[model samples]
Target: MTAESDPWAAHARRTVGGPRPLLTEALELLGRPRRRVALDLGCGAGNDTLALLERGWTVTALDGSAGALALVQERAGVHRTRLTPLEAGFHQVPRRRYTLVYASLSLPFTPPARWDRTWRAVRRAVGVRGWFAATLFGPRDGWAGEPDMSFITAQALRERLDGFEPVVLREWEGEIRLAAGGLHPSHTLTVIARRLSR
Candidate 1:
């Protein structure tokens, strides 16, 4: 499909020169020690992947959309050597360890039935003492009940984050303004956590 007809492509194009506040914050929280590798899971438009590359991290960027991966490759250009773009869904995430795993607004897209398995794979990818930064949809999110989406309650979140030392825990429950100029009541939990010892 043409970029005009593909929403993912259109979003990737729009992200080219935009400010990525979440990525900035995530990097700040991750500190400046300069890790060697990172995995940008569900790297929608490659903003996070680009940021990782700019910071001198060899990155593996995975997205379900081919158009999104294309945008990532296009944006990488000279940095292509440090960037690996893979077009695969959540179920196809490769088994590997990484110093950092970034998954912004993407994990919830994993079908509810497959979330546990996916989370297991994600944990394996992070290994011990690795970091994880992501946004998880809360039960009250507008899209929580969607068939293919997964949502967690506050208590459930605590259980899920049990082994990690949460560096940043920000929760919001209110109307979210969409890029399409529409608003929807939503709840989201943004986290930057480090695996302490395990």
Candidate 2:
């Protein structure tokens, strides 16, 4: 696919920024005092990865694009020692435990056929009382039915959060202006839940 047609490329170009607001808010709400190991799933451009590193967390930033991973590594600069950049798609996430498993605006991009396994992998990667923060697309999202993507309703989402004690579960819908000067509607569920003791 062409650069414009590839969602990962498009997002990498526009991912310049500090930590996402949702991430910052989630951390504030959790109030966890210790630095934790983090897995930044689909870490496009490393915005969230940088945030985690700044807070003294060891981070494994994984993405499907080699270019994206390169950018993340470059952004890590002197802190590269704490950042482990890996090139892998959703289905290839390695088996590992983490104190924080974060996926921001990326989980929905998992191909439908592999989503079940990916979800299971995601859950298994979290350590006891660890945090899981992510942005999941809702059924009303403009990309709801896009191929290779997944969207869930509020009720279904609740069912999936069974092992996580919710710290923040917020739903939002609005129009987002694209870099192409077009508008796209978005409906998303932002979650910041702590895993229950297992």
Candidate 3:
């Protein structure tokens, strides 16, 4: 199937599972003013991008697919004033200071060799006391064996998240349909962290 047929289009079809129940707690972290800027890394058609915008955060939507960006632009409507859809590779994307950085299920696509650089990029891009939420593929994910994909064991990932205090670290063991429409019930790991003080 062609890129137009990527099954991820379906995943994007689904809404964010639920409003972040921890949002109030997160908001309390802000001393006075609310966060104004946010980044949706690997924003994949801007599903979460839309969610963030709805909450009044100006968003920079980044995705590797032109098609995805197009869809985002269309869905966002007048919110376009607050949205900047970037079509580019993760490596080419510059580090910008943002209050929240969300990667969803997309960072797993970053090649393993580039994982360290990309991880550091994410850490450096967000502002002091910023928030980060993402899903990482565990070593046991079926795709872990894929030569070019990045998958880390929970231990390794925990180590990578060393400095940040995790607000949520959850795991799932089940079949996950791929972006290509194939099914692989595998191990999935998700983490949401926040920079505290530093």
Candidate of highest TM-score = 2
Best by lDDT: 2
| TM accuracy, model 2 | 0.92
lDDT of 1 by residue, 137-180 (tens): 89889997799999887677767787888888888899977765
Model 3 Cα displacement at 183 (Å)? 3.4
Candidate 3: residue pairs that collide: 175-185
TM-score of each: 0.90, 0.92, 0.82
Q: How do the residues 39-111 of candidate 2 rate in per-residue lDDT, one tens digit apiece?
A: 9999988999998888888999999887778778888888899999888877677788788889999899998
Model 1: residues with Cα > 4 Å off, grouped in runs: 2-6
Poorest 10 consecutive residues by lDDT, candidate 2: 1-10
Which residue pairs show backbone clashes in model 1?
none
State how far residue 67 of model 1 sits from its true place (Å): 0.8
For residue 72, give model 1's deviation from the true position in Å: 0.9
lDDT of each: 0.81, 0.85, 0.73
> Candidates sorted by lDDT, descending order?
2, 1, 3
- Note each model's CA RMSD in angstroms: 2.0, 2.0, 3.7
lDDT tens per residue, model 3, 1-198: 345575444445453243343334444454344667877888776767776778788999888776677778888887889998887666555667888777766788988788788888888776777887777788888777887778877788788776788877888888866654779978877777877644
